[model samples]
Target: MIRLGLRLTLSGGREAAARLAVIAAAVALGVGLLLSTLAALNAVTTQNNRNAWLNTGAVTAEQEHAPSTADPLWWLLRADNFDGHLIGRIDLAATGPHAPIPPGIPRLPGPGEFYASPALGALLRTVPADQLADRYPGHQVGTIGDSALPGPDSLVIVIGRTPAQLSGDPEARHVTSIMTASPADCSGSNCRVGTNSNGMDLILSVVAAALIFPVLILIATATRLAATRREQRFAAMRLIGATPRQVSAVSAVESSVAAVIGVAFGFGLFYLVRPLLAQVDFTNTPFFLSDLSLNATDVLLIALGVPVGAAVSARLALRRVQISPLGVTRRVTPRPPRAYRVIPLVAGLLELAYFIGRRPADSGGQIRAFLPGIFLVLGGIVFAGPWLTMIGGRLMARRTHRPARLVAGRRLSDDPKAGFRAVSGLVLALCITSAAVGVINALTAEQGVPQGSASLSSTVIGDYRHYDDHGNQLDSAASPPEALLSALRATAGVQGLTVIHADPHPAPSDHLAGGLATCAQLATLPTAFGHCPAGAQTASVGPSFSVVGLDRLLSWPAVWPSAPATAAQLQNLPVDQIVVATDGSKSAIEQARTLLATAYPDQEQPFTIAEDRSQMSQRLSGYQQLADVVIAVSFPVAGCSLAVSVAGGLRDRKRPFSLLRLTGVQLGVLRRVVMLESAVPLLVVAAVAIGTGFLTAQLFLQAQFGYSLRAPGAEYYLIIGGGLVAALAVIGSTLPLLTRITGPEVARNE
Candidate 1:
């Protein structure tokens, strides 16, 4: 029986070969996409693991303060911002001869030497020394190994400093050894930094969830192509004394052979496109090529599972043939789907509503609570699709006057499940796209700065004070030296300068009055800090004020009120803040920042309003890019599924269509019939899916952040429009085939 099946599948003429080819193509697409998603996830994990050790500290405050001579190294990690990019700086000091080395470098460097990642090294060569290189203060000894960096574009510097140089820094740790575990695996104060991949992981999970269903649908649809013809052939064999089990084995063998070929081609397709996939920056940094790979176990599972699943689906499709061969041979229509098929969808919606009412306080909590509802909703769409199609078909049959409408509606009502299956992939893709677009547009909206403050775009504010997490002042450096101040004033883009003096003994209630400046000097400050009070000689400065909160303070600048003060008092106070107004050009702003950083390399770098906005938008942009990529990939996959299913439908109904043509029906009428058969169920279910998606997005946002519905961006409309057009185009492509198949020469009975 197995040998017979193989021969039939391989050499059963052109029609059989076409069926095998279509099935193989659909399965190949599904497997390729599945493996690609899995590889991307693996890359995220690998990157997180590689960069984990840099953020993990092994010493306590006590050990850091009074380190024993036996301690191997002193480690201090600091973050530096250049333009809008973040650079990680690790300052190391060797305290003992037998210091434990980090993963990237061969040995610890002495003073005046540092190791830079390949990306950072290249950056240093391109950017001027005054802007970035001056901060590192060392010659590049070598490049850090890939093992120490998260991705190829990561900027990292490992500098060697003397023990005395690091002793003054309170945050520095006296390290005995480095911990290799990621932040999620580490506990307590030892994990100095939080994981950066949480958002990426969540987005990827959403994408994976959105994609997997369509892939499965495509595979199932592929297996069922030409299913009616196969059942008839099997029914004849059954009537000729073949056992049901033997018939089942033959069906399984045919489907499994196509699937096995598809699996091999899928692996080839993944390898072919991997380099392009590696270039997508899901977290604002492209992944290393080697990171995006499946392990042996994953490979083995996919290789075995796909073919077996295909075989099973093929076997299940022949149940009618097995039970009573005469039923299939006589072209019996199966029982219609029931109203209860819609229950799961309603239940899922109710579950989502229930959770939304509870309103979780944190995002993590909301995600955990919404997962079940999301799964239920997705599953419900699949369950309710056939029922919805049946209802729509019956309504069309009742109302339509056209012959095409009557024929299409009757066919749909008889096998609504098959009609729905042809376009199910598209319905699901639109649903996921709608939800993602809604959330992304809302979250990525810009929080613009106040009006009339555009002049502050090139103004730089430098502060020399450090504060703890609670906003309490830890310590403040003395005013900038006269030479540094002179050099800054002479900088190419510096247009104006103002010095803010610190009040030595501010009253207990006057926490914001850390600095004082003359009214004329304050007037020269950024417009964001409202015009100095009229007729006031001196006024107090706000707490470590910078461009960071300029947007929030626009409406209430008077919170730091001005007061009367003597010129002697202003002169007596120490300087704490330096404001430099530039030429309003990007280069000018960067030049001023470089000078300040050179003066106080250890303190936070000076910042501009533009840079602050850029930094915030940069993070949001990454999410937008990821959403776009996922949507872009999904549309073609769904289109392919729709195309294959439409072609298969034409092939199965060729005899009926040819007979209609012979009976004097026009080609135009037949085209409309085919179009309506696919489009009616598609348009109806698609509308429902889209509404559900937006509703899901709104509920999720409300539970997580108390947010209401916001309009999605232009891209949302484009995706939805493009998806519809693509579906129509795929359907149209099969129309010509309909005309060819229904010719008088091919209209004879099988």
Candidate 2:
């Protein structure tokens, strides 16, 4: 009896299986994405662990203070409110005539703790440009800085009870000082820099996972109906003698099998993408990571849960094996009260609420815009979808002059439910396509980021080489490259010329070696002009971009003409250092940086070149983020809707075609009506989808996400054309199916 029941149920499940296949594919897509996300998280955690173990001595209770006022090192070591040992002291002082900023000194070390300083960057510490900057920990030399802390004049101190006690200092340039941690706290990059590279991506991964479920549910909502349609043969067995329970069990089995297959496919996709994911290297950035964390838990969860969930979801989705009293009253009519009509009302209230509740507290502009746009879409779908179906049906009926055309029109009206489904699917497809195109356009647009109102166009700082008066090239090996500047200033077409050399932190190197890049806190006086004032004194900045170029006593920038150069960045530079390009052009920038370190062991330096955005357009042209799977699913669902529409148009002729073949009408005429009907709705739907898609695209991607929506100008129009062509193709594909004139099958064929 069970076997008989199983056969009966399986026979009735073709329709459900067909519908559920699409859902299964969508499920597979979700699983693939989930796998990738899990891998990324695992990579992050693994690297975090390795890093913690590698740099274990970074945490301490010393407060690791950077003397706020008047060299606090002296005050810190005074033994007034002390407990453990006093890690030495750090200070800066003018060591020569051209000493960077002859400010108060800040370097000292009571060796007992740990005196750690790097001799690498000391070469660039122009006593005249900066002192203590070369002394701080983890400071970048040439990156973003205001050239603070006189290098030659400033120094860092490291004093403690033991060598291990002064193992690592806060990246106060030069890693100036290190001291013991009473209790070791092996922390990750949160304590240092570069520990967490893809924090934002981690959040995005979770969101991506959440979005997957909704799309799957919507697409698969009708799967059961499909199964029932296809399994008529099996259902007949149940009518004869099979039990209902056995029938349901067979359904469960089929659903379970499909779900498992889908999950397996998803995992295959995940592993396929792993190699590509592993190739990314984000090391230079302070927040970079060469290795992403990968965890098995996430992958395993999806592998196991998705299959079970799919099976359960299928089981629950099918409400009953027993035919309802109403089911027995079964009507061939597919019409259901148009649930899509509420779309408009829901959308309206959402819009009304959007405008009323918005506030600055929510980061206005984009968020406010997102509100109304979303509501409008939902409303449009609900209201417009049903309306389009009714109207399309009515129009077909109204326009059909002949008996054949007339019959097709009324049939379409009678089947508005199916019509609505197809049109809605088309509209949805259009929305996604437009949104994706818009984002791609925004990302690949050739335009550099503007700095305030300044435009950075194609300006060149041509091959940089310097020459002397006698046409003899100056030696770039020994001293600061001053000769090159004089010659460049003399050259024509040189709209602006400003030479940047390395600025050093006066701090020691070891403490600086452990990550957190900026630690230089230079004291400055204001200038009259908006810029820094150049004088006997120097200016400095931390590794980060915040500007601190003035002391309280200096005149404001409005009153001064220039920003001061520290002694380190000016006319003076340490002698004897013939900076070599060690690593060569293969890594010209990195090689230059490394050479600087080898030559001057005790200062901070930057990457070889600063960012220049003269050709912004040229830089952003190659990225293509095409989500093909999504497009494939959407386009076909839309085509099926088109086929139903065409079929509706030929309903009266379904019998006529049967009669014509019996009497004498041509097959071609039947084919033509199918074509005409399909064309009409396709065009109508294409127009609606295109128009709505554009508006939705502009609203979400640009207005909401702050992406550019500039008329891809002509490109956008071309997109409209593409949409039309796509609609045509869908209609065309279904012509064969639509004209399947089965010689008047049962009387309902009409």
Q: Estimated TM-score per prediction? A: 0.91, 0.49
Q: Candidate 1 clashing pairs? A: none
In the range 318-367, model 2's lDDT, one tens digit per residue, is 44334531332232443434646656645643554344434333333434
Q: List model 1 lDDT by residue over 1-750, tens digit each.
A: 899999999999998898889898888888888788788877877877786768645544533464344456888887666665678888899987887678899988878999999998998999887777877777999999999998898888899999998878766777776656675454455555534444544655666677667777787888888888898899999999999999999999999999999889989889988998899876568899998899987698779989999899989999999899999989899889999987887776777777756867654566667777787788888888998899889999999889999999999999998899889888888887887787776675434333245556667777777668686777766666778778877888777777777666666675456676767766666665655666677776654455435445334365355756665666555567678877776566777777887787666667775665566565466667777767877777788789888999899888888999999999999999999999999999999889988888787766655667689768688879888988998899899999888987777645
Best by TM-score: 1
What do the candidate models score in CA lDDT, each in turn? 0.78, 0.39
Best by lDDT: 1
The whole-model C-alpha lDDT of candidate 2 against the native structure comes to 0.39
- Please estimate how well model 1 matches the true structure, expressed as its whole-model Cα lDDT: 0.78
